[model samples]
Target: MKPGQQDNMREDIYQEIQKQKAMSREKEAVGKLAGRIMHDFNNVIGAIEGYAALISSETADPVVREDAEQIRAICAKASRLTKELRNIAAPWEPESESRSSETTAVLSDKKVSCKILLVEDEDSLRKASTRILSKVGYQVFEAENAEQAFEIFKKENPDILFTDIVMPGKSGTELARELKDSKPRLKVLFTSGYVNEKGKIEEINSNTGLFIHKPYDYEALMKMIGGLCAEAQA
Candidate 1:
């Protein structure tokens, strides 16, 4: 090859590499922003689902109940959109056959006395979850973040640590690890809209820790907690 031609080819390859790196950085930034937005949006949806449940249960009026149900249906649709957003942010591989089957299995209604330490930064969602769990006869303690959660954990020594994955100071996984170090028997259930930290969810699942995605309804929440409580008993 001619010297000029070779030089031009080298420059072209370098430019292509730089361009690829720039695109990668841009994608990473977008993913981070999307993660934050998904978390906030899911929190809103969760709050809506909670309030809708409250309205449906408390109101005797059939029309009001129907309206509440409609709201819940809307929330479900929104939840699916958020799930898509999560995929765009971080394309998660499909769960394995065994895990998929386990998730699909019908959870039994066996009652077991259990205490849950619910930790989430979002206030409305946390309050709604607390109300829903408490209404279902499970004792629930609430905290806004992991630091407060640890304090409650020390005091309550609850059966289940139901917490969000992302938070301001300490992430839920860190809290779970710290608490579990002290009390290995404490069952940990992690919830999140989108996992910002890669493989953390898989790590938790691998360790037999429980997880429920955000914007989950009362029934889903109850089933997860119930399963955890049953596991604790077993």
Candidate 2:
């Protein structure tokens, strides 16, 4: 074979290998993302199941019970399919958000950084989050769960409430609604391991402005908190 022809053939072979590698990498990324999404969905399903069981036994009102049961059924189906359809199938991951930018922006010009009430059931996370906020020049109040957070919120009336959605007694979503009901202008920043399942946050109006997902780095969390808290103030 001519030398030029040999070079062309080698180039063709290299290009084919690169294409296969790209496909393989994409497949791997999708697989990991699907697994993470399913795990979060299961957490939401568990919460719904527990809530339904309580409503079934405790509530005398048939209307409330019916609504609870419907929620339970929908979440159960979502859980089942999230596990079964491992790939990007029709029954799975229809609601996943596109990959958002990693950058987190600060809110408008403000001198005294907003006071933050950090509510998380996990102790390690609570402490770590507190230090992060403090480093960012905010006064931080720490609470282990939603109930404690409520007490703090009442006393401190901190500029912003930072809470975890999946907590023991009172979830973050419920807390946000409760606060907003009492004080229409309450500022809340809710974080979650389960953002997609049940649309727990879709109902959030302007009062509850920001959401941070699990495993978010320090910079991103602060930027989100700063921006939302600034907006709430404005």
Candidate 3:
């Protein structure tokens, strides 16, 4: 093959690899979201099962008892599916106990002193992110949208705003802008799964940092949180 043709082939191969990598990342994100939903749904089902059992025992009427029994049976089926989900969602659960214990001890001493408001529209992502931040010793308040986030911000007066760039109601950029207008010193960290051709994310205040991509691991999350907190303290 000619040199130019060889170079073109190599470029094509590189692009293909990049495409594959992106697809793999997307698949991983979907799996993570599925796991989160399964875990939360399992908890809800457990609550329902408990209530149904209580009703079954307390109800004097045979009819009511039968109804409660039916509910319990339905919850049992849901429980089985959630268990499968847990298996998929936390395939690495067995390996993390030691790491988690060590991490907890380390975090126990290094106590992060900043209050953070975390806003994400997706319930799974919001819950997962909140749990990670809380585990790492940061005080994290979560919200599903910009409106709810504003309410929390008012009550919490959090030192930092860690928000998803795209959200229902008002976008993260708008929320950050409005809040910064009032509290100019407020440090912000933006996160998102998508960005448009218009560069909407780049519109976030010049004082703030770039977007942290979605599906971040705990280490990346901690790094972002640490950076934002350190900036605020400085």
TM per candidate comes to: 0.89, 0.53, 0.54
lDDT string for model 1 (155-227, tens) is: 9889999988888998888888888889888898887887876577666765467777877756767777888
TM-score for candidate 1, residues paired by index:
0.89
Ten-residue region with minimum lDDT total, candidate 3? 94-103
Considering TM-score, where higher is better, how would the candidates rank from best to worst? 1, 3, 2
Candidate 2 — worst ten consecutive residues by lDDT sum?
99-108
Candidate 3 lDDT, 1-234, residue by residue in tens:
999999999999999999999998887787778755654554455445445554555568999988877876776666556545545554433211110111222223357889999887766557655655675578999889988988998899998998877666898888888988878888888765434323563475353654554433234456667887998899
> Which segments of model 3 are wrong by more than 4 Å?
1-109, 205-207
C-alpha RMSD in Å of predicted model 2 compared with the true structure: 17.3
Give stretches of model 2 more than 4 Å off. 1-111, 205-207
Off by over 4 Å in 1: 93-112
Better of 2 and 3 by lDDT: 3
For model 2 the local lDDT of residue 220 reads 60
Which candidate do you rate higher for TM-score, 2 or 3?
A: 3
Residue 214 CA error for candidate 1 (Å)?
A: 1.0
